[model samples]
Target: MEVKKNPNIAVSRNSSLYFAIGLNVMLLITWLSLEYKTFDKPDVLLENLTLIEEFEEDIPITDLNMPPPPPPPPVLSAPETITIVEDAKEIEETVIESSETSQDEKIEERIVEVSDVDVEDIDEEVSVPFSVVEEVPVFPGCDGNSNDELKACFSKKINDHIIKNFRYPQAALELGIYGKVFVLFTIDKDGNVANIKSRGPDKMLEKEAERIIGLLPQMKPGYQRGRPVSVPYSIPINFQIQN
Candidate 1:
């Protein structure tokens, strides 16, 4: 057989066919590589992620049924400063004065308390004479009926009587008692003695002096500015037991 030659045409057809097949084969390999790589991707995470952790410590927890401990007591603080105080002392003295007249009166006035069992009844009685009061000076005897005259006469009469009968109390003499006894009396316009009151160391002495003064005779009446008037008077009786 004799060969007919189209060498360039055959070469063109075979080159085109070979080039298309190579391109398709290359595209298929790239797709298969991409799928396998995506399917086998590595699991990864970024750094600085805030991680949370849960733990169970061995510390014991109180039971709901158990009682709790008591709270602590409050504390007391010391004072910043202390103060001290001192008391002042005082001195005193007392003095007392006693009256001899008051002592005598108290001694005579005090009542003696005797037991009834120790007391005895007596049937006998004793009668004693009235105490003798010396006569007092006679007043004016209404000679000068003036009130001043009467007052002067009455005062003189009473004073004289008091002087004559004045005696020292035996107890007072023994106890060395000495004092002035006060006497009060009132004179009337008729020169007569009105009210007479006497206080002395002894009641017996006081009464005896009063009785003698009462016995004085009528005197010239007392006078106020030359007119008859009544007046009150006070006198002191001084007795001396020492001779």
Candidate 2:
């Protein structure tokens, strides 16, 4: 008896769950049937249309009158008469005689005798030796009463100039270069120094010596035989580097 009472209670507990499952299955079947159904579409009709418009208005027409171009000008006529005259004469031609000497004539070659002329007296330029110059070049600020004294004074002034303007090149000093450079320069007739030449054991020393000599001021030109002449002067410069 107790087991029979329990059968209804077990069936009642599962009845609500089975009803929810059946309701969900029915809703899914209805959605699938609606999705798979096909329906016919309505036909669309189209017709072509044309519109006509008429406009009436009066338009005025005008005529154009043009004149023709002018005719060409008349041509000119030339005279048809011509006259002729004839004259006969002899033409005279003048004859010219040439003064050129013929090859048969003896050609005389004259010898030009040039006397013993001093080179200094001529217009030609020649460098005069310092020793033979009648008047030595006068240096600035050097006082002398005679040519000999002036030459000595010039020598002294040259030494003083070298001492005042001597400068050893930095590169030469760094290399410890030591030597004596002989610089030869010319004093032109214009009293300006020109044609500077230098010789030494090292090129740097020679160049430095030439630079110092070029800085010499303009002086009186030397004279040879009472005429101003170029004087060639040479001097020696020594370079010594101190440790």
Best by TM-score: 2
Which residue pairs collide in model 1, if any?
147-221, 147-222, 147-223, 148-222, 148-223, 150-220, 150-221
Local error of candidate 2 at residue 151 (angstroms): 1.1
RMSD of each: 49.5, 20.8
Off by over 4 Å in 1: 1-138, 141-159, 167-177, 225-227
Q: How does candidate 1 score on lDDT?
A: 0.60
- Candidate 2 per-residue lDDT, tens place, 160-223, comes to 9999999999898888888899999999987899999999999989989989989999999998
TM-score, every prediction: 0.32, 0.49
Sequence-dependent TM-score of model 1: 0.32
Give per-residue lDDT, candidate 1, residue 153: 62
lDDT of each: 0.60, 0.89
